[model samples]
Target chain A: MPGTETAYQPTDRTVPTRSRERAAYDRELVHAILDAAYVCHLGFVRDGAPVVLPTLYGRVGERLYVHGSTGSRPLRMAGQADPGLPVCLTVTHVDGLVLARSAFHHSLNYRSVVVHGTAHQVTDADEKRTALDALVDHVVPGRSADSRPANGKELAATAVLRLDLAEVSAKLRTGGPNDEPEDLGLPHWTGVVPVRTAYGAPVPADDMDPSVPLPGYLAAL
Target chain B: MPGTETAYQPTDRTVPTRSRERAAYDRELVHAILDAAYVCHLGFVRDGAPVVLPTLYGRVGERLYVHGSTGSRPLRMAGQADPGLPVCLTVTHVDGLVLARSAFHHSLNYRSVVVHGTAHQVTDADEKRTALDALVDHVVPGRSADSRPANGKELAATAVLRLDLAEVSAKLRTGGPNDEPEDLGLPHWTGVVPVRTAYGAPVPADDMDPSVPLPGYLAAL
Candidate 1:
């Protein structure tokens, strides 16, 4: 465990072999990165091979929840009586394209969090409801309250997996390219092209009433 | 094999358990999806557990190249004698937010490509050079020619792994939210919020000549 409450302890698996300076164990940074993304790449072993799938996820405190139909492979695997399915969930945001004068120095400015742990199915009724709401609200803040909650039948069909954020690390690269001193004078434009997620105007459903006003939470996006 | 050259034959793993309608084996669609993203979540088995990592990748024809320092674990694993390292490379682009009347129906409009294959280290110098050039060009079209090629020392330090895109599938969700007929009358806003990747103005390195005009390709972004 970490000596401080605000950070997570570095584990053998979480410590990167190279560029150790890029890794962070700050708890808040991990939560912020996880909450900002709408989807996460969840990886698990199947038949002795690795399988990675993009899925919706929600972070409630230090616990991360991912849901799918009960028949889904990962969820079903997590439901097994075994301690849980070992999974590595990762979230990444590309902030910029780092172009260097030397081809060897080219890299991307990105922030990514990697979680290594076992994922168990959420069995309690109330906890599953909280996860379901978090899943909906994670997409659009205050969405669960605005939309109708899942009915009993819908709840039964869904399987929620919970992974505690005990072993995690965020790796990031920022600023411009790191070109060598000799290559600085090369005749190539060297810089960063900033990349961001942009949200466009919302289009109402055709079946809905045109008078229905846009909610404040969505407009805030 | 696919009945025609225009598509990929979906294997058991490429075929999704649910939402089969969203799966596409079209070759061009798969390439377009792969070309649009800068980062991919790469999964490989590590120490008998699943490990997922976000890394930069370049797609050339039917092959995907991922590079890192020769000391990296995955690269070292791929360099081993037996066959190659089994990997699952997935790229996802969240196109829009699907807001439905019922929580159960909420989803994200996304385009994703999943490639299931074995990765082998590129030991041939010529192939490695081509893969490195492709990686640089993938960041910004027409960039490799403008930049200085990697030197002998740099080329020897970096390692590139090649994975052919023979087993691939593209899954996409588009348009607005799909609300149930009965729930359409709920007192909530229903619509689709478009999400896109926006590129910002390029920022040159502090040491770069201020007079260097921005390249046409970057300005076009």
Candidate 2:
């Protein structure tokens, strides 16, 4: 089933066994989580074992393009005659450290989105170029227009795996620690320490002429 | 063979097919990358399909412990009457966004470690407790001693999987973007926009007593 208009229906694979309350299938939430993060952990099976690697990804509507080189095994697999490479792509943002009164209750405040689907190589030249632009813009929104697009040689050397954002779920844990009633009186301090990604001033290339000013979009970061 | 006195020998799975120059097997580098992060993407095979999930993990010397509930399928599989589960655990920290002259050359400055090995359920109660403490302290070192240790009931409720750090590699990208000679002359603003994890002031739990001050370890973060 395509699910309702607002949310994707949860499937067995997308539903977590524990902490079921934290999982959500709202399409907007999924997109928000995916769009906010540029790096993703991509998992694929090889030689009957799981391999997880961190890579850059870009989301265009319901599809995700993972940047990789053509020499990579997973990318080669997707380009092969095989149907497609089944993968699990996950992105997470740790919001805070949940320090509870008891060690058992200690946890992290995080928002994570997991997508289960098959990834295929983007063989279409136009789609591949679009995906590359999306990947660049993902790192810094509107960056593709500021930089030179991939040339023919560069495009042919690169590999892009497009994974549709179907069978997706987002899990979140926020607020403060949930210590037990008995442990509340303990001497230990309980609270949440907020965590975030901070960006420092951009450094200009040593060889660049001073006249080339920072882009307005990157300056905003 | 154990490659050297201070580095783990490279296994087939630990080597990167591409960007081979960025891969390192130095034990110290691997430990540093693993210790600095609390969350990891744990990958395992489920029904012959790869599944990756974001979870908290702790490192004790050469052993890495992943926190999970007994109800989870991977944990259950590790506890079942069978060989250890083949898993790949990865931790990544995006240091900065490398804005290159060309979109094709754009990349991220990141440090990551990938461990591919078998994970066994920590059946020993002592090790499990130690792992739990390590997991807590990994979030904020020395905070484990400041908080109440898990009770017997809590210990029994949690499930842990221990993976030895035998096959491992640390991949890193630092410095600025490496744009091509021809593209360097372009007007594009090129350089690395540094990124880092920043921690804000800790917020006390609503129910906590005002007298209990923040611990020194957490305050340092």
Candidate 3:
């Protein structure tokens, strides 16, 4: 029997050892995890301290774009910094809860990606629009075509930062916990506790015009 | 008719201005959101610089606990700090994707908690065990009772920190996007695209003894 072909190459950029089996180097696996997640926890050192902020993000091919108000502290800091701000952007999808025979070993089945880079602020108008469109489409596939584009005032208030997917690592953990042979007979739960996310029936805005129908792209989602 | 009275106060921790009709706030609500999620983005600043890191966390009644190895940079810096580390711990649950008739209004329906406080390290053994149990049970409810308690050696290697619930806020956004009245006739999709989390069938560990039955608590999850 032949073994499966591996898509991810073990390199300096990949975390080949931290979690040997769970870590994946495959590009498709990496992209799937990134694409499925809607928010990214962006970590950066401001002074000598670390701060993490949960924010909206969009991925364009291998590049990731994050937007915020120009007046936001991080945005201002990134724009003014000499070497730009070093940041660790992370996105995670929690698939299930791992129930181990022992509490000490209980874990979660998840997919996560961490990107290390210096993000620079986008200043050009065309680039800004393109990034903004990517952001909107990321949240809603056809949204850029439906809504009015950002006006001058809105554009002036917004700032978009770009970080290429140059140095990144994806870590994953799935399946049951590794229980010791003796501990297995101790009589405890030993399977995945499933976690799920579902959409409830749509609630239209109280002031909705009711003449328009819900879009198919959103309907499919 | 008068509304039902409850013990959990909705005043302080809940947002008064944006009360989510579909959302509920109570101890159960708080615990569920905290337990189902993994990885909290801790935000803090050192020397006027901001930084954030992905770290493991556990939550007890009205308090959230985080731990790191003693050699961890943040732990060392936090131990020496005067007012402890000024930290913001945030956990978010992305419930669904909101598709708006207009691109500008596209948003995500999510439930998130933001906690602001100074984190202090845990030095006492009893408190450490309590916090560790909370962390364990936060991920798996009954397993804490079944597993071997952390021995002295393991406990000695971990550094635990705590943040109270006094300065915490839980914000939630649910349902479809609120499209503008005039934009309704523009023939755009405007409904929620559901996001879901599903679990594959369990794969037992190869080394399991096979004599022990899966516990009811784990099965219930």
Best by the lDDT measure: 1
The candidate scoring highest on DockQ is: 2
Model 2, span A1-221: residue lDDT tens: 44345887789999989899999999999989888889999999999999999999998888999978899988997888378999999999999999899998888899999999999988899999889989888889999999888888888899999998889999999999998888888999999999999999999878887899989998788
Residue-level lDDT tens digits of model 1 in B15-103:
99988999999999999999988689999998988999999899888899999999988998999837999999999999999999999
TM-score of candidate 1 chain A against the true chain A: 0.97
Query: Residue A203 error for model 1, in Å?
Result: 0.9
- Candidate 1, residue B80: Cα displacement in angstroms equals 2.0
Q: lDDT (0-100) at residue A145 of candidate 1?
A: 98
DockQ scores for all predicted structures: 0.88, 0.91, 0.33
Scored against the true structure, residue A10 in model 1 reaches a CA lDDT of 93
Docking class of 2: high
Q: Is the docking of candidate 1 incorrect, acceptable, medium or high quality?
A: high
Worst 10 residues of 3 chain B by lDDT: B1-10
**Could you tell me every candidate's TM-score relative to the true structure?**
0.98, 0.98, 0.78
Shift of residue A129 alpha carbon in model 1, Å: 0.8
Q: Which runs in model 3 stand beyond 4 Å of their true positions? A: A1-29, A45-49, A80-83, A146-148, A151-153, A200-214, B1-38, B43-52, B68-86, B165-167, B174-176, B193-214
Please report how far candidate 2 places residue A25 from its true position, in Å. 0.3
Model 1: how far residue A77 lies from native, Å: 1.4
lDDT, candidates in the order shown: 0.91, 0.90, 0.70
- Tens-digit lDDT track for model 3 on B121-206? 88888989999887777665666887777767668877888876655556678766776666766555456655655544555565
